[model samples]
Target chain A: MNVNQVVQSIREKVAEGISEVYFVACGGSLVDMYPSKYFLDSEAKKLVAGLYTANEFVHALPKRLGAQSVVIVCSHGGNTPESVAAAQTAKEHGAHTIGLTHNKEAALLNYSDYSFLYEWGDDSNVKNNPMAIILDLAVQLLHVVEGYAHVEAFQKGLESINGIINQGKKQVAPRARVFADKYRNEELYYILTSGASYGHAYGFAICSLMEMQWLNAAAIHSGEYFHGPFEVTDKETPFILMMNEGRTRALDERAQTFLNQYAEKVEVIDAKELGIGTIADEVVEFFNPVLFYSIICVYREALAEVRNHPLETRRYMGKVAY
Target chain B: MNVNQVVQSIREKVAEGISEVYFVACGGSLVDMYPSKYFLDSEAKKLVAGLYTANEFVHALPKRLGAQSVVIVCSHGGNTPESVAAAQTAKEHGAHTIGLTHNKEAALLNYSDYSFLYEWGDDSNVKNNPMAIILDLAVQLLHVVEGYAHVEAFQKGLESINGIINQGKKQVAPRARVFADKYRNEELYYILTSGASYGHAYGFAICSLMEMQWLNAAAIHSGEYFHGPFEVTDKETPFILMMNEGRTRALDERAQTFLNQYAEKVEVIDAKELGIGTIADEVVEFFNPVLFYSIICVYREALAEVRNHPLETRRYMGKVAY
Candidate 1:
């Protein structure tokens, strides 16, 4: 079934009452689920939503998880042990479980009530990527259960996201190349963003920069920048700022203004310049994360080339028993 | 009234209903409130709790912050503009608002339905510190509204906490001095902890290390270590691991084992060795944060002395426009 039809089926089964939705996974998979949680938190007035690391979710299983809860678990290959255990725990607690992965024969699929396959490494099928599919599940559930008015706009967004991502990657390639050359020798980086766009900066910082390149990086939330993190900003500090074109845009702009004044090396990446304007205004923010993620992938590739370090190089992951 | 009586009064006033509680502040104040949120999430079966940065709380106010909500705002000197604005926003939404600060004349007190003062710079009155008082509010409310059985033990903990903290400082002083000497030249550090103890590591990393000393640091959650972050762990990496004696202790231990195997400069400060054992086992976890926070203050002070950098030194915090 399609993402919408699978969500519709779950909605029909839980028609009597549904109070909560949980998104749980690890690393990039956990980061991919944030936009869906952000969408639900922003749109649903009554439904509760939570995003957690898979092990934390399993260790502290919410008392509210029951027949009225929908737990969404994801792993790219559907082989993360903690994520599989979380799905099994959710099932044991009688919560409806939905699993997203590229592998159909994985243990996560066996434990979940509904399994949805998303495309992996397929540039032509961006809509079927894990991030897009999980977000669609949220969009569909909110539309069916809580009467979302932007369903049409959201659907249009899904249809045109691949073209928008391609445009974004092409537009940002020159800047990405410059970033790679300039910061090639730098040891640490700080990626800043906020709201629905936070996960993209986070996944790129951890998965691409830290894990792949063996460099130090941290994702600093733009809204929280003025609090304590801004003190670390100076003329030599390297910062990558992700700006959104939504309600939290003012927060991002405020941080941008500060960074421009105090820091010399600030890379400003904005969703408005990435063809999100082609999408309907009502649902543009929901598409911002995928655009940011796709363009940042180009940045990662550029860095990998300049540093002579492959994106898949690992020191501990899958190499040692960590 | 005392902290317990203030909470009791709020409980009586909101006898009709209270479904959610939000803890909002900035910097160290925000970090200080996480244990209370963690306590509510771990103990309460029906009460919903959220911890957010003050600006985010004001900008993206939760839809559930209405008549059936309790919003708690904290600022050390009570002059943080965002936190005061959050209290006003909560009041405008008809929620029961509680404000904690050291200043009774602050604007936060004016906007809040109830104001409680916590002692500052008074080691003799450690029980009345901001973290302890805010946590007491949660404990008292839970006992009154939801019938917590650990009330007596929790009260005993509050009474004896100051003594425990003094003893803890004495116990960890030598280790703190050694840490200062070893990392006096280091420019970046990562503080790691999990569960209720997470706030201590976070507050220390941001407020003390970054904001005060102008060093770069990030608080890494221990449960999330195995995902993407463990790749950066090496024999030369400086890590401060805070161990807990709570339900999430196993997660901390797992990370501790990995850090021991891979990292050489790990400083392990545990709750069990710091006199938390004197408190009742049922109520011990809630005190872990305050213990961690207090001892870490010693470490920060030691580092400040050895590095010749005052903890009050800042380039942009209060010197210029944000």
Candidate 2:
């Protein structure tokens, strides 16, 4: 299915659960919950969103589940054991459950109350970007709750999405080129980002470098860097800053100053505003981390191009144990 | 400041606040407040100890700064900005403040109404280890609260410590021997621990690795792990589990089995009952992160030895920031 149809279907499905929503995910499935949590906290404002690791839902946090809760189970392959367990657990506990998956009949779909099949096109055989679709669905859910996002506006938003993707594709070209020029040279690599984009920055940074390139990379809070991490950050071993307009924190200057003292090269994503900040900033500066992440994705894409590496299968991220 | 004499002095001074106690600190200092809190929770059962991030004591926490409240600030350098602010803020509002420090004339000592010096010998030049005297002195203060940390028995316990330290030192000896050791070879390291030992585990596992090794390590709750971070672990990149015998957590073993499927290595510390489970385990467990940290330190020490390098005090791992 094209992105537009995916948008329409997800909106209709999400609108059904305006009161209670639960994100049931394991591993990276949890990261997909970020946008939804942010969307709930921002858009619907009233949409109560909670996270439960698929297995822990039965043991500890499952008690927090209310009858009104709509459990959203996210598994890439729809076969992860804990994801399977979570699906069972939520159903057993009498919660309405939905599944967001790339595969339709991967066992987990059987337990799903409603399931969405994200068609990542040709990339489905390669690195599946269905997790991104999950975010779109969550955003749609939030919009339905807040009366902000609708079929027309969201579709328009989706239409505007392509241009930015193209822009993001080009935006990170220079750094990708520079880093590509220096790829196998460095013995160590580190990435740091804070504010709202941190979880995404940390996750994306890891999966990008380690999953694709098989490099050792670390991510942490930017401010906490001064507490200790800065000592190893020197000219010979520099670090990367997720210098996107990190939500509410305009820490680029302070971070840059400290980084400039040690880093050999400091790259900045000068995209105007990429983060989906608090509801207040959403009206003003809602685009920082997303665009910045897209830049990183583009950089990763470019690196794949230069290295003659095939695109990574989502399966390359390994699997979740039950 | 021999360990024995130093231990005695700190014990005598902390007794000055036996009626009611409040442990105040920020950052790691706030973390060190755990044992005292646990002690009050279990033994003193009557003393009512509250551990607050010192700065909050003046505002939301310490409305009653009367002499009844004994605020013990555990700071490595004894001069954290917030801790200092909290000390001043507490003293201005009439709370009796105590400073625990290695440096004699620290700013925190100036603000403290009572000061206990943990002078661990001439540890100034060597950034490697603290003077044993001070650590023992800090241990002594625990006795004053409820007269439970029997000095005579603990002195014997101190003798056994050398053996445990040797075990730790020996366990990590091989870790440093390779640039590509099993632990450091990974793209990420996550340390998880709980109960009384959480704060130290959190600090040492997360902070120490970042400070000394520049590795991306995430340290969090053992129980909390299943809720979110557990989803990310696969057989290739798994988490390090800190296992100790205390609370009956059926969930931990289940979580471990899941992680074992995907983990590169599952490092375990058997901090089980030694008959001293009540006090020593609580304190040692509360400081278990430090114990585990001490192991990491030796691991790095071995690494430095094998690599013909020195323990790079990149960020002064123990240095407090004011």
- Every candidate's lDDT: 0.85, 0.53
DockQ of each: 0.60, 0.10
Residue A301, candidate 1: how far off, in angstroms? Answer: 1.0
- Per-residue lDDT of A276-297 in model 2, one digit per residue for the tens? 2221333322234444556677
Put down candidate 2 lDDT per residue, B151-173, tens digits, no spaces: 56545544555456555556545
Q: What is the model-wide C-alpha lDDT for candidate 2?
A: 0.53
Model 2 spans with C-alpha error above 4 angstroms: A1-22, A38-49, A52-59, A121-162, A273-280, A283-287, A313-322, B1-202, B213-267, B270-322
Q: Using lDDT, give the best candidate's number.
A: 1
Residue lDDT tens for model 1, B22-53: 89999889888999988887677667778878
* iRMS of each prediction: 1.6, 8.8
